[model samples]
Target chain A: MTKRIQQFLNEQKPATPCVVIDLDVIKNNYGSMRTHLPLAQVFYAVKANPAPEVVNLLVNEGSSFDVASVPEVDLCLSQGANPDNISFGNTIKKEPHIAYAYSKGIRLFAFDSEEELLKISRAAPGSKVYCRILVENEGAQWPLSRKFGCEVEMAEDLLCQARELGLVPYGVSFHVGSQQTDLSQWDVAMTRVASLFMTLQERGIELTAINLGGGFPAHYIEHVEEMPAYADAVMRAIVGHFGNRLPKLMIEPGRSMVGDSGVLQAEVVLVSRKSNDDCKRWVYLDAGKFNGLAETLDEAITYRVTTSRDGEETEPVILAGPTCDSVDVIYEKKEYSLPLGLKAGDLVQFHSTGAYTTSYASVNFNGFEPIKAYCI
Target chain B: MTKRIQQFLNEQKPATPCVVIDLDVIKNNYGSMRTHLPLAQVFYAVKANPAPEVVNLLVNEGSSFDVASVPEVDLCLSQGANPDNISFGNTIKKEPHIAYAYSKGIRLFAFDSEEELLKISRAAPGSKVYCRILVENEGAQWPLSRKFGCEVEMAEDLLCQARELGLVPYGVSFHVGSQQTDLSQWDVAMTRVASLFMTLQERGIELTAINLGGGFPAHYIEHVEEMPAYADAVMRAIVGHFGNRLPKLMIEPGRSMVGDSGVLQAEVVLVSRKSNDDCKRWVYLDAGKFNGLAETLDEAITYRVTTSRDGEETEPVILAGPTCDSVDVIYEKKEYSLPLGLKAGDLVQFHSTGAYTTSYASVNFNGFEPIKAYCI
Candidate 1:
């Protein structure tokens, strides 16, 4: 946790199961990316954390936006963001929503299929569009499937189809996955993306931009390479294929931009063993899969945790949320060691939960309100 | 879909991604449960669908409530439910919440561990408490882990401690699991519960009740036995051991009571294949894992889906929600056949979604509001 957030928690003593974001950390994360990956324009993925404070900071920093919906478009615009700086990033959108964004002066969009392309053609006519190519997400912690992108051949057809429908086929895009660790995966995606750019160029449809979608790593339980390592790998991969004259470049960073900027605090409601001989004690926390900590589903994103009683003797324990649903478990098979003295009312903080936590919380599930947030 | 909901959908076209609940279906479902399981008092599990309309209807029908949180307790009381009829049924609860429920005149509470029991004794002294025993959830579609219950021996010690701490050691409780299909699982839990009661009786701690926690199934894509069959099995198991000297038996029914009473309608935003030769088409709906359909996380609870065009030639489709998140895909591995002519703007209704769908929705995960609910 950042010093600002720690100080805020200490001074404010907000209720349990709330997240605190340090704007300084967000600014620093953005600055570090700018210092390293100088070739690409950064589009702060708004869906990561749509808090007005975060968006306002990014807007002041001259960061463009990657929005998923009309409400997100309005969020950025209402925060004094330049309409030209926003890109409608989600491939799935209602036709009316597309028209609304177009009316609000959004000129760039993302599409993976013909139906979406057709919608963009009619709704946001003449807008610059990028076709997401389906690439291998083998090494990402939160790997994506065939849900958001299409095959290289289909992407080729779709981008070409965009031009015929009075739209600009401006770029090609692909995401390795969220929380991507393997630098080589970028090389893999860039290879196919570069190949597609060439094929489209030969057909007299020259694409000028490559939207490098978000796959940057966040600080979690597992160690990942530093930002410079990612920047160097990405630069080298791009130069390896498209040597001298590069296309206009853009990067969409979601989790990496704000993930490490906040800490989520929850109180232990109860801790007990199922049986006398049970090996693991189940530690029930006031916050869980519903309110926050959704990335803990399947233990995919393991966040570093610290307790108020840290440094005490610890033992492996099962972690659960305060819900009647059986699937409300946070971590069970994955061994989460806790202080043996931990009991009801002990406080615990989950690190690097700033991205998907508050944004993914359920709306009053089991009569529990969504986790509250405080931006410092 | 019920005739009432169908007519309501036909007449009043509320926006897509809204659930229409037929109060008639809820009343009938409760009546059926009452007719079949005459020996057990009904406790409507409020976590399933805690709509004020649903709670008010059940209250008028003389149904007790199984509440998981303080907000739920307040919701029931605010809707004119008798405080005596509400059970604070969640094993995990905050001390302040317990006190609040107690101050509101709630007398019944659930506990599974010594720490929880201690909290209850300190907060809600003299409240009637039931100890939950860890039981096998075999043959359940959504099997629970060792999250909410303690071993039989642990339960015995806790109950004895409750009596010493000036709390009423009223009963023992166990859930087979949610969406449980196997009838024999009830017998398995009943045997353990009976053995615990006998052991407690020998120790001079006379427990006067046995709470059969919710394990009842909701009608989904899978065919389940009628409510009478479940009532018969539960009755047989309880009688085989208790031999007519039955305690004040209570059965908590969450999904089964309201699961079949509602239908959720969503519009097809787009439908396209990932590749030209790809056999399965990808169908994107306005609603997704975040807004609704959280139960389809692992395709565990498959709701019966019907499109506006149902009788045309059918093809297997990969269903997904309208969000940027990759995990938002509903049923990719599970083959859901849809009409070949299904396209954007066509309406689709998910049947048996009344219970868990609306209650589990996320709080605007991707700029989409929580699914609207209409109780007709």
Candidate 2:
């Protein structure tokens, strides 16, 4: 945790459980991602913790946004984001919502089926649409063959249908999955998407952008591989297939860009002994499954607990929350300790909780207030 | 599903994701609980579903409530529920919220420790307190021996301390965990609580109530044992321990009262084959881990889906939701069949989702609107 964060934690009233974003960390992350992927324009996936301040920071840093729904698109627009910079990345089935997006000048819409093509034709008329193709690859973290995309075989028909409707088939896109640690999966997807784009060009359809939808791994724990190598591989695959004529690459990175830049802090309310002789203990904090740290079952992502007090050595402690339900536990039997004298009134801070922590999670369980974010 | 419920589903506007509760079923469940424990006054745990309409129905039926938080207490009070009838069953350190409960004439509170007792003495002077005793029965269903309660030996000290502070020590309480099926284990808790009450009486502390904090099992699935016989055995043990002098018995039944009363109606968004033979067909619904169904991690409470169409023969299908996260799956490899023609936009309802279904959970994952209840 940063010194300014420690001082902020010390001064907080502790009346409400909240998520705090270190704008400096976000700036660093944005700067690093830009430097690494200089060729690819980054569209910050606002679905992961879409606070106005977070969105504003990403917008100020020259990052576009990938919005899945109207509310998310509206959120970005409300934060002073450029309409042309926003891509409605998810397949559109809701005709009215699609028409609204088109009216707002969002030309970069993703389509995966004839039904979506018809919906887009009827709703957006003459909109420049991106055909979302399924890139089936073995050994990838998550095969895109699951749902919500046109099969490699169906891509031609879908693109032809868009052309028949006079819709601009601007590009191809594919999302393998979220938290995809493997870089080989991007190479496989790029290879498949490149071929589809060439076939479309052969059919006399000119494209402008190829969107590699966001699924970049957001590592919370240390020692997880960084993404610069993966980004390089993806760039290589694009050049190998489409050569210098490869459309402008657009990568919408959600978790990676913001996951590690935020911290959620709550006061410890109770602590219990794991065993009579076991040194480890279970500490119950005010925050629970209701907020950002809800991926308890999927232990791939976890927050690192730190004390605001300086020079405090860490000990392993299982963190529980205040909800009455047993499943309300935030972390499963993990060890992370705080200050030796951490008491009821003392605050415990969790790092790397910015992404998908608060924007999508706020139910007000136990009458606890929603997370309040403080940027910078 | 009832005819009225089917009609309601047909009339509802097409929304991708929503939770619909049947008011008629809720009333039926509430009535059924009264029939099971005819002798004891029913205090419907308001934490189960604190919606004003839901609370009004339960209160109008002559059922009091057991509230765990100030907001819950305030909710009941707002619906005209008498404060004297409600008990603050949570056993933790009281905040300024305690003063509000006291001001509302909520005299009853639960206590588990010496530290909590001291705080309560200063915060809520002269309040009627219930000593939450921790029964040291290893075989006890949930031995809440962790966190909230005092040991059986500490009961003497607690009773003495309550008297010393001019607070009314009117009763004793014990919880055998939630959704516990072991009737024999519950008997052990009753026996221990009864014995502790006898010891307190011998020590000149006359109690007026013995609260067997409710853990009555509701067989959400088939072939599970009923709770009536268990409740009878527990009552018999109380009578056996104290003879005719047993205090006014109270039970904090949360799930049993509302667990079976509610069903969640979700729209099928998409259907696809999970296996080549279509033997593993997946019917994706709108409800996911964000809702309460995800709490049944070990199949403790299983929800069965039924279509609104008549003669809806069941076909085994895996259920998933629209969330991008892989873990958003609600039913994995679980077999359930819906109507043959049931496709996207068709309504499928899950049974036994009343109590902890919506009130105890939320759409914290996608930040969607909270579940709305219909009283039809």
lDDT of 1 by residue, B237-277 (tens): 99999997988889999899999898999999999998999
- Model 2 alpha-carbon miss at residue A308, Å: 4.2
lDDT (0-100) at residue B331 of candidate 1? 95
For A33-91, candidate 2 gives per-residue lDDT tens digits of: 78887888888877776777888888888889888667777888888889889888766
Q: What is the lDDT of candidate 1?
A: 0.92
State the fnat of model 2. 0.10
The numbered model that scores best in lDDT is 1
* Least accurate 10 contiguous residues by lDDT in model 1 chain A: A272-281
Q: What residue pairs are clashing in model 1?
A: none
**Superposed model 1: Cα runs more than 4 Å off:** none
Which fraction of the native contacts appears in each prediction? 0.85, 0.10
Q: Model 2: C-alpha RMSD to truth? A: 4.5
TM-score of candidate 1 to 2 decimals: 0.99
